[model samples]
Target: MAKQSSNRATQVIEAVGSFLRRCIGSILSAGPIPKHIAFIMDGNRRYAKKQNLEEGAGHRFGYSTLMNMLKYCYELDVKYVTIYAFSIENFKRRPEEVQSTMQLIQEKIEGLIEKESIVNRYGVRVHFIGNLKLLSKPVQLAAERAMNATWHNSKAVLSICIAYTSTDEIVNAVEESCKEKQKGNEKLLDEIGEGPLIDVADVEKHMYMAVAPDPDIIIRTSGETRLSNFLLWQSARSLLYSPGVLWPEIGFWHLVRAVLDFQKNYAYTEKKSKES
Candidate 1:
């Protein structure tokens, strides 16, 4: 009983710390804010193990954290937010884990369409960027519904990557371009054979995120420095922030710190370029 009480107290203390950090961060943020931000929410299972919680519980906590982070981003007047929710590589995990993740995604998509969700309240547009064919029928339907429901919103956009892979997206775009060219360039198609030949611009035009501008900042939690195949094309000029905190433990302060770091670096680079 004493140990359980101790654990409960720790949880309460951590929650309070998170609240305080957010309040402080909001006060400290005074410079130009990023218009777009992307997140690679990593280390869910590790967070679960560290907290002595179930695997699903960690993902649930991550969902809550994402909601809170979005609120903070909205407060900062960020117009675009993208999250790497699931990767094509993640399908290699245990079947049970993948199933649970699918269910969670479906729930989140449905929740986004709810009357009280941020999508409706703040006129936030929701988009899913990935291979929809890989998702379960219900989850895919939910994603489509969420996108359609908020398609007209102009205030903010939230993009969730589900079964997304930068390489796969590039390959798919090339294939699409080839098919389009085949119909129009019959003589060229006959001369060049069946190879998929597409320019970088052609692929960019077909990417799932074609409408959104490249992310200004990309934040990866759990101290992961690698891109892990997220947004290869769009992140070329993006400022990266790697915080040691796990996804379930991330809060607004971490984001604020990343933005400040970006501001400092951007100013330095701008001044150096002008001098040159």
Candidate 2:
């Protein structure tokens, strides 16, 4: 009897929460909805330390928070979501710590392609962005499998940037653009007209992040305002939101607040994006 009562109470609470979210969603729909949002998921380690949990527990919790955020974004009809999952600089960490995080990432990535996973539920196409060659072979294979498994979906996009930094991406794009010029591609020659100079379009075509539009808003948790080498080129016009809460502690309200802030600055952001 006690178990039955507990289950009933849980169901009731969930039902009430769902209704409240729908109400907020309706209100948000009245304004301009952002087409893309990016996240710097910082402070997972800090969260773990704060909670006095084991070494990786913070990331595990952060992953759960990410799933919930994804669900919220999809429900709001936001079409593109990108996350700064890992950076090239992170490889300098202690070998054991790096290995543990990689294992956790591999395990979760495999789960994403399962039949009932949220990616399938929302028809989200998964993209593994950045220099994937830098990742360990097993992790790279897992990422490739996830991308292949979800490529057919069209409802939305989820770009996970691993082994990525904006500066590196920029350099890679420039090098690829130069290589094309060196190949004496007739189209490139005509565009530049007798100089080795490459145009913005030439460079952008080779960017790792060319898969999606530039983000409308970037939310960095743990109250960080700096971009931290993440999406520097793409964020010329994006609104930045820094909430004091840690990534694992972030909830639906944080997302709602971010969107509201974006809407408030919609005019300025839209104007700047066009200028760029």
Candidate 3:
């Protein structure tokens, strides 16, 4: 009887919360909404230590928070969402820790393609953005499968950056662009004494993030102000928002606050973007 009452109360609370969110979302919809938002999900280990849980448990909790954030972003009609899931530098962590994280990532990535998962629920097309060759064979296969599975959905896009860093992405893009230009004319530059200059367009076209527009807002949790090599090339004119809460503890209100802040400074952001 006690358990039944608790369940009833929980259901009531959830219903009320859902209604409140809808009301808030509608009000916010009246103003400018970002077309793309990027997240540097930080502080999983710190959160786990604070809560007296295993480090891996923090990542698990963080993944749950990520799913909730995705639902909220899609509900707000944001067309593109990007997450800094793993960085190239992260591979240098302790061997056991890296293995654990890889295992967890593999499991969750596989789950994302399920019929009832959020990717399908919102018609989000998934793209794994980064140096995918650095990933293990199983992980690479899983990522390829996810992308293939969601190839038909067109409502929105979810870009997951794994084994990614801004410097590496830039170098790879430049190299690929050069290679394309040099193809079938390997001696054109030598013979003509000049070659076409590689412009911003050329580099950008070859970027892993070329599928999505530049992010309007970049949010880094755990009160971090640094970009941490997440999207240096793409964030030249993006608004940066940092909330004090850790990744796992980030809630709906934090997202609301970020969006509100973005709206408040829309004019300034727009002007800066234009000037860029």
Candidate 4:
């Protein structure tokens, strides 16, 4: 009798929690929603240490958290979602760790090719933005295949920054733009006829993330306070949000808080963006 009573209470609590979540989601449905949301998923290793689990297992759990967050963002009508999946500097880590991370990423990328993968389920067009040549051939192939497979989806976009850094992206953009100019005009001079040579727009045009608008909110987890070279140029008017929760511990309520915060600051962000 006692066990049955406890189970009944558990059911009631779960039902109440679900109702509250739905109610909150409905309330915010009418408010301003951020079009682009970027995440710097941190603290996988720390979470693993705290939980007494293996390092790789923490990252796997983090991946699941990311997917759940993506679903919440999509439900709220967010059009673009970008994640700092891997940085170019990450290669400097120990060989075993780097290889493990790469393998995990590669597996997830290839998984998107499955018929009922999350990419298809959410109609998300995946963009693996970064220095692709720096990745292994198999990883490159998987990334390419994932992008191609999801190219037809237009409802949403999921841009993963794999093997990427803002500095590398900027340098590549400038080099590519200069090369294009020289090829077309057959001259090494920086100036074009009507323009003052390479300017901000020119560099931005060649940027890896040019396809998507700048992120309205840049979120860093695990209480990190720095941008860490992620989306440096595109974050001029973005509202920075840092919740003390680790990546694997992030929940819908955390996202709800972020959206609420964005609602309160939307006007200022808009005003600032216009001035810039």
Q: Count the backbone clashes (under 3 Å) in each candidate.
A: 0, 0, 0, 0
Residues 110-204, model 2: lDDT tens digits: 99999999999999999999899999999999999999999999999999999999999999999998888778565765776787578799999
Lowest lDDT 10-mer window, candidate 2? 184-193
> At residue 186, what lDDT does model 2 achieve?
59
Worst 10 residues of 1 by lDDT: 22-31
- In terms of TM-score, which candidate is strongest? 3
Model 3 lDDT, residue 224, Cα? 95
Using all chains and alpha carbons, the TM-scores for the candidates as numbered come to 0.84, 0.94, 0.95, 0.90
Model 1, C-alpha of 17: deviation from truth (Å): 12
lDDT (C-alpha, whole model) for all candidates: 0.87, 0.94, 0.94, 0.90
**Model 1 per-residue lDDT tens digits across residues 33-118:** 78789999998889899999977889999999999889878867789999999999999999999999999989988999998997
Candidate 4: residue 145 Cα off by (Å): 0.6
Which ranking of candidates, highest TM-score first?
3, 2, 4, 1
Displacement of the residue 17 alpha carbon in candidate 2, Å: 1.6
RMSD for each of the candidates: 5.5, 2.0, 1.6, 3.3
**lDDT accuracy of residue 102 in candidate 4:** 95
Off by over 4 Å in 4: 1-22, 187-195
Order candidates by lDDT, high to low: 3, 2, 4, 1
Candidate 3 lDDT tens digits, 15-116: 898899889999999999999999999999999999999679999999999999999999899999999999999999998999899899999999999999
Over 112-213, each residue of candidate 4 has an lDDT whose tens digit, in order, gives 779887778889999999999999999999999998988999999999999999999999999987777677575546445566557888899999999799
